[model samples]
Target: MQFMKFRKIFSVALAGALLLTSTSLFGEGNVADAAVISSIPNTTRTLKSYDNSFLSVTGYASLSGGVKDRSSYVGTSYYRTVKTSREFLQALLDAKSGSVKVIEIAANLNLGWKELNLSSTEIQKYNFVAKYEDPTNGYTNPTLQANGVSKINVSDTNGLTIFSTSGSTIKHAELKLQSSANDIVIRNLNFDEMWQWDDVGNHKEVGWTFIKVNGANNVWIDHCKFAIGADGMVDIENGSSGLTFSWCKFGLEANTNPASDSAIYKSITYMEQKYTSNQLASTSLYYKMRKAGATPNQIMAYSAYHSKCHLVGSGDKDYVNYVDSNGKDYKDGNQRLRITLAYNQYSNVGQRVPMIRQGVGHMINCYIDDTTHMNLENSVSSFKANSTSLARGMNARNGASIAADTCVYNGVTEPIVGTELQGQDTSNMDPQWANLFKNAYNRNLIVNSQVTNANGTYTGSSWDNNGVNLFTKGFVWYNKSTLNKWAWSSSIVGAANMSKTKPPTTPFTFQYNYTEKLPYSYNAVPLNDVVQTVKQYSGASKVTLSAKDWLKTVYSTSSTPTTGSSVNVGSYYRIKNVNSGKYLSAPTDASGTKLVQTADKTQATSLWRIVAGDTGYVNLVAQVGSASKVIDIPGASTDNGVQLQIWGGTAGADWQQFKLKDNGDGTFGILTMISGGTQGLDVNAKSTAEGASVIQYNYAASANQKWVFEFVK
Candidate 1:
């Protein structure tokens, strides 16, 4: 019904798949299709079977990641693996309308670094703006003023999908999607460290959010583990449309590792170097350390880090941007601010379980549990400072349409902000927010009854904030309710010109909805099963997958490499680079001998024997002067041009071991798992001349990285 107002942005506003025609979202199952096939032994949550139906995202964000959801080969034009923060940001920069990419995060990349190290060529070639937050300005030198925003600007594109492996986290940063970002999917990652040293800790002036989707469309965020951020978890503003959040855990734990080398502690140290003394003393850190008597290392360990979960629209008329079939674009209600929340867990959070100002929202089987804290939050900066009130829930104003079906709440004060803000100038009881409570059902309103009971009745007295007022009293939870009445109705406050802060030149009434068919169809798991399902399969590592295995699912092929792709154990061979047509050779089978690409394959130094090594990998032993030494990435350096050498190794360490990845053709790309991502062997500069050097580089599937194995055991 939400999409009925739309004039079809692309096609006929697909009912089956949101924006694309695909298989059903849930695939008619109760359990999740979340398992991945894994062979690495003794892994946690080791998966044995995988259809991955749950991978099909439902609701407004179904169009994200284009038509496909699985990761592809690194050699493909659209797929890459990133480890560092710069690489992660560069992956976003390299994508746009014509260029689409899928980025797989391989490590916990910290974005709080004060500067980006730009090479000399980029320094001399361009006149760059010094704002480090925005890397589009060439060389970025981060200043504290710019909000340190590294954007995933997928402009005018069908989509860009960013996901992560089991061990990766996008820490100490904020991900903002703005300016015509379209059809994006962010999945299977951990996020944290937006929490900084707020001056007063009122959280009014600190403007750091975990993920801000501004004017972006068809975005789906799935299976992400969001930690305690500085401000809100997600703020979808300025008319972003068709957003979905599925199986995400917001605020599981605070980043409390306060060791000197910890990310949060390092950020604190970095902030100390840039600010004034008074500014430093006014920090939330100072409040915790000086006032609450906490050490620098132990101060953050007491943070219950989440507050202000989601804010759908910044203002009433920050309308969505939409496109018609004839290519006409409209920035209005018909195409803006529609969101879906399915199977999300909000733990130890404060409020705004999505306070939508306008547009439509559908919440199915969501879990908003705020009963406990993840850390030992002090009274000075606890999310609930008053110690008398409970956390507020969903609120809607400005005639927006919202409905919560089969949702659950734990220790939530107001299921829909009715009792919490009754006397608090809610625009004539905020009649528009009535359904947010009535439709969702305030289980807390029932006396001595379970919130999970479908047939529960509410005869209990309404909630009041004990004695603590909105202006403090250091509000804390675990207080007795003070107020005795409940109020909510269709007090839909509407204005001819809905804009509150910024008014349009010509005033127009905002299109408000009481109910709107969802833009897509989905089968949500029953309300009772939500807790179990989410607990079993939400956030990173729960849906265990490696980039390699996900690619196998996409290609639908065997796990093994192709013909002659295997470097047989105890067998000798002369390996030749495809691009250079040169043999992999060294002068002597001794330590420190650099491997070279020689033209003559018949030379004795060119011969290599394969020894058993790590699983799915082999140690290439060079045979020369009646001695054997294993091929090694010297010092296991991950630099781009690190030369390979033959060294002695009783066991092939990850550095000494090389794995063969089949290119499907007769050739294979030799890679190492130790370096992370696709670090592979390559011939320098594609040189065909004899004695050309061989080095390790990021795998781009270039001819230099592909090798042909000529067996001669």
Candidate 2:
């Protein structure tokens, strides 16, 4: 069998020509005008119609006072207004008071105004005098602090909506959602400088995560901005589920110091001390010392136990083997956290854009512009012992899974680094865990450019224009067949070398046909292009309520099927006939028992697993007890009416492998590798009778030829 070849890169002139063609087709218009058009609602329906229509809805009342001197004991009547971070905490704590609450935050308001407005000396004095306190781990009553506030808790609250109207900024505060905080929405707010300062002056020693979703469910954070945190900007852990972060931005503010610097120093010093003293200490004690204003030498007494700090998705707790309320361990079911990150932008952020652990993540249409700060020099020093850099645009670690599509990365220059889309299982503890990374799917576009800001800020017009134009003109969304073709044809190369490789020119063009005029101008661009439309609204300023609503409409009504052409390689499934509700079965593990469709039953004969084969084909293995059997063509025949049967699986048998052609309507047509897509597996004579013979025949768009693989344990 011939494997697919590597893709070639386009020349500079060819790439420019293709970009120009796309621009002309999509109507070249000013981005500022597009931004204005995005703000206006496309439909005339009242704004209230969308109140609960989306998972994200904005319109919270602001509090009267500033950050300082704000009351934490506000009544339910004042719960709607959140003028200070303390009040915001109280409002969240009071979310359970009402059946359904909508707490609207004031737009263009800053929660940390008092601290931010203070002079440098005043800020230092405040840090010096204040006692550092750590929030309790699980559910507890709100504790009053020296600042006259309580530790914020959102445990056991449901049907809560906390949103910023427009252009609101929440600075210097951490939002913690733990102990089963469910059905929450936070959107359109900027979380800036949410870090705690050590007694001496270091702001990176303490845990000041912007949003921590621990043991929560059904939370949506949309169209928000996260910048400059002491730890992870957002850390979702402890079996959280149904979380989505859409059209958000994750990056550093201009000219700001990173928290990773302190984390690295602490890690290195701790490691040196551990090696010299031969004493092992709990990592938590080191954090305590740091918070208690330990000297450098005092901190050096501990080993570097916590190195991968100060990044997105850091400190992710294990979700496996979680015991539910009934004392049942969900080691294999309902224990992994699931997240969808769509149409977001990541720039100048450290590694873990994000690093998933014991969960699954789907990242679609994201833009990663730069990774200079995530290089080896800035990464955890211990990580450099084995690899050049610890940076990963998207990574799945310790049996986690990730699927990334239509992502674009530019201005990354690390050669000996981790995989841009990576999966690592170092211990090889479980056989299933060894193949977890094979579940990862990545289809990305890499561009070579030196786009940089001298001040390290991403807010100027130049940055905006570059980001907007790249989304509008330079990206392409591939169909299932095309994506599979590309995946098979191209080799998985590092991001540093991706710009040098070229792909087929046809797949680089947009999939939709242009007819109507662009939304903002008279120039016509393609309509019904889901990826392009979503990309147009990916930035901090462009992702308005109207844009988000428009995106929701497009996403809901689009005909795109979630599954691609390639079958889930490592997943076990039941192959059922679309015409007849029966599953394809092998009566025995013998070599020549004609395959037949049988009634659904809880037997191994009815279950199959798709395994990756040579040259981009898949082998369907029968889950018969202790039998290494696969669906095979008898006598290695390539005839049209040859029957398929279960036989002993060979290492590289072409006749046993099949290519699954996605019909784009939730069905797959199975074609044998021997026939080379000329023939497909069909129910004999199109009969719906039980025990009918399965045969290979000329390909046709018939229901008998289509199959759906229902996931089964």
Candidate 3:
């Protein structure tokens, strides 16, 4: 009941349109130039425009002019104005302004830098190597001589901005934010192919994160495009807080390498067995053995062969931890990585959209579409091996608290339709793995359409309850209204909100003009549209942006609607009579007691559970002495003015049923089931005293017939 009190306290509004001058590039001009800022003080804000003028101008410069020497860098012959990737990275790391410095990238730059290669010692320092190598599989351990690395480490930096120039992309690089990187904003950039292949043509695992937020705070990654990476498009871990990823697109490449069919089959088999048949035997037994004094290597050997293999491109957890400064385990009171994932789109990407661990993630208005197994060769066959279907979507583990609100999950129709939500409780091994949805509130799981058989036949079953099963598994429903809210909000009602926005095409030009066709191309959508779409549906959309504006709106702090009489089935309530000014009371441990209106008291006898019954009626069960006894009319009395009593017997009997009709003024009339509901529960003689008896009386619509159900624990 205490958790149910948590409510959203922010709001957003669309600003009026403004006029601006358009700049031309290679004979193209007349584009929208005015920047629009939606200021929501102390909360996140959005600035929309082509140029970077909307951002802070202090210690900022354009890529071609003040930041770097444009003449020294060799630009492409076709697009001479575009800066090279090397020049961009150099200027970014070299910037020591001691204040916020913003670098607006001017062109689509190639991030292939062979000169900045790391030595083996440096590689080991970064822990960028796999401990074990599988000779038969294409998994080779990373070695400096055998692998190529190109990464830009933004270490010890504060107040930095590396946003894309309007219609520009940063290709083939990993933007790594080191520890203590704070107040950084990276937006509107397309990162593609930050990858490397081993000798056998297998993609290397190192340096694949498009944007890695490692132990950073106050980082905002908005309106970016991420695709064709060997690993995660964006990974935020390692104590990173106050991070927001908004209006970004994480999609697939046109001809990207699919997961190996053999490997996928093995992985899925391991997962299904560990989760279903063995009940997570590998993890549980490993911990048990460790407690029994097993060595680290022995546990590693068992995990390597028996446990589920880590899937690449799935958001991994190498950087997340749940430990304090003194090497103690973290508890519920520990500070968590607070992140907001809003208004983003994911298409055709592998699992972990994203794989969450040990954080409080507010996922609002996200559209995850076309999630499928990458290994199409054995996808159908492998899917059939498991008893259950496999659909890729958000995976929350390791005590992560995710509030997934207004999200749409459109499953892949081909092969096998998978589940939209997947979860496992690993909290027993560590105290931090306590409850996945312990902090979750107002989560609405929406499936675009019903999942069906591969040949388009209805499976006669549904995945509508998958979200509930995922978070509530191995844990109790913390706030009982959570399930009720999920039931009420879960539907395919918000698909139009995920429509893609059109980008301006007239003034934009591809920096690297290509005659030969490439394997993949970028699906570019406008940043402005993405921001607006997110702002419209995000949780913050409920409240006005500013205090002045919020005051203007009639916002209710109460979780319950003031006018609705529809009672939540599991919610607790205290019924009070209007005329008596007292609550309906029951005796302690008594089989039957003449129900009397007594002074309102904070005791178990005063609470009641509104158990739902057939035909929109409810049974009032007193919450005293196991709370199973229902308010019953003795002898099934049909005559008016018969006294009500609490009886421990079969519910749904005519004597125990009552229809609560809304008075439309925050009160309800309890119509009794006796005499075909012609009588209502009334205070005896319409008395205004504290000890008034309640009885089944003929309906008069008087003050004694009305009651208010106040929500209580």
Candidate 4:
């Protein structure tokens, strides 16, 4: 049967990987690798490098003071003289004139931007980085003006750290604009020693912090880690789009080693003394230097902003569950850690929380566990709390208008107009926050146990609970959106606590088909490699028997009834072969063989029959040349209500016809219409009954038109 249009797009990225281990998963593959790019008539040049290059990375190719007219060439590091940041800027200006394509720098390098003429005014979009031989003590520049530089990829051996020499915090990066459309990629690095403490006079303050791109689009910080003692992690704001922080480790504390105590302590004291002389507060120094020796100060901790950085892969939980200074847990709320509200287009995600006020601040798929403070203002957003065992606080009383909030415990307090709140069921399951207020807890905890809280009482059980029972109590859950973003185990196998007898024994298989009971003689099979066989008989043959088919022999019959009494019923058996006099010659035509009901039986039961008859001569006929053939077969005299139809019927076939088939309760109508054809019957309209005809008729509905298709094994 054809399914609805709501079917999902099959994932293909990791299909081959997932298929190696299991059979129930599909993933989307990489689209770029398979992309085909045609020809472009442009001169292409390759690059190679040697020792030190005193040459500037700006537009033109220059060696010392002389300008070369050559297009491209592999050169050494000593091509130009070592100079100040001003020379670098001048070099860049000249390079753009020649339309230089690519620049490669190899080995021991030091880029001095101290004299660089970058302003705090213009937006610069330059993609450039220097590779350092020693991962440590590399690229001292982290402060760049916010140009429209879209992409930045930084790689160092030790870690990638950026600190400011100026008194102000490193708010944004300063790069020149080469292209407005740029994608940033920073990998194989860590932000180490990128923070500094200030302890000048009496006023104490946190050291110099780096506030990364306030509003840059498509920032990806992958395969990188952060060492302790940075005032701020990468501050991604100002409507950064497609922000994916994958496989990057943040909130990592520095390791304490006695061997490095002297070096570490000297640097710490120097910073303290220098900042103190600079008029920094003493209290800040005391708190920062509380731990003596090699232990780094508590720079990064779980805070409203610090704890909610965008994370992917293994670092997902680190941002939320990190221990605070007071050992109390804290998490970001609506505004503190917000995903830009997502619009129909994927790019709208960044627009949700655009840096500018009165701008779009739409955040989505965010977990506001415990310490999250919701303060949505002019703009509305969508927040999804997927914490199964976590009671996320949605203190929306701060006057933030939320369009949609899923699984959050606290919000506007009372339900708002045009707002939907699911998960308040007080049925078989208990929906409580305490059981769901822990890490790595199952969502089933809320559904299995009852919790009598001050707010109200919630009752329900399992994911199947829906309707008002789920809507009024708490949060609506297990939605399609959550499933699409998160990964679920395909081999998840566990037992339910309901009852052994009620749910059947273990070793249950997974079946992709609909959940229902199988027809008689067929047992439910799991989606495993096991298979069983049974004999299947044809139900449309002329030599058919009534419902009184007795068991030839019971496999293991007991005389004593367990709780019910048994009564024997009259039965019949099929002959090894049909005798010409006993059965009619089955015709190859659409009607098959028509038999008449005995006159003694009621009209309902004896309406038709298929007994011995000559070819082309039916014993009893009703629908002539119409599909859905109906025959009145006689049961017992009082049991004359049985009316069966032939399965092999097309449109306009007489023997395959029925009318006004009532399902006893009179709730549905199975109308079968014979489209301009004479083969299989066409169901014009049907609200119930699988594969049954739902046809439209020109006249009144009759018994000769509606017949249920029942397969008897």
Sorted by lDDT, highest first, which candidate order results?
1, 2, 3, 4
| Model 4 residue-pair collision total | 111
The sequence of per-residue lDDT tens digits that candidate 1 reaches over residues 133-223 is: 4222121112332335333334555557787644367654566777567767777777765655443445554556778887777788877
What are the clash counts of all predictions, listed in order?
A: 18, 10, 5, 111
**Per-residue lDDT of 335 in model 3:** 26
* lDDT string, candidate 3, 427-470, tens digits: 33233222322232222222211222222211111122322222
Whole-model lDDT, model 1? 0.54
TM-score of each model, paired residue for residue: 0.53, 0.40, 0.39, 0.25
Misplaced by over 4 Å in model 4 are 1-181, 198-211, 258-267, 271-713
- What would the per-residue lDDT of candidate 4 be over residues 1-713, giving only the tens digit for each residue? 00010011011111211211111111222111111111101112111111011011111101122122211221322122213333333334334343221121111122313222245431143224211121122211222111111112221111111111100111122221121212333322333333322232121123222224433333333334443232334443322333433223333212223123222333454544544465434354333333222123221111111222222111111112223456543221111222222111010011111121111122212211122222221111211111011222111111111222111212212111111111222232223311221111111111111112224322222122232322123334334221112111111123222222243233222211112211111111111100000000100111111111110001112332211111111101111001111111112224324232121221222222222111111222222233123332222111212223333322233333222122222111222212211122122232223223222333223332223222111
**C-alpha root-mean-square deviation, each candidate:** 16.0, 29.8, 28.9, 34.3
Cα error of candidate 2 at position 566, Å: 40
Residue 120 accuracy (lDDT) in model 3: 76
Each model's lDDT: 0.54, 0.46, 0.44, 0.22
For residue 412, what is the lDDT in candidate 4? 18
Best by TM-score: 1
Better of 2 and 3 by lDDT: 2
Q: Is candidate 3 or candidate 4 better by TM-score?
A: 3
The candidate that achieves the highest lDDT relative to the unseen native structure: 1
Q: Candidate 2 — which pairs collide?
A: 8-502, 9-501, 9-502, 60-104, 60-105, 61-104, 63-83, 270-303, 270-304, 271-304
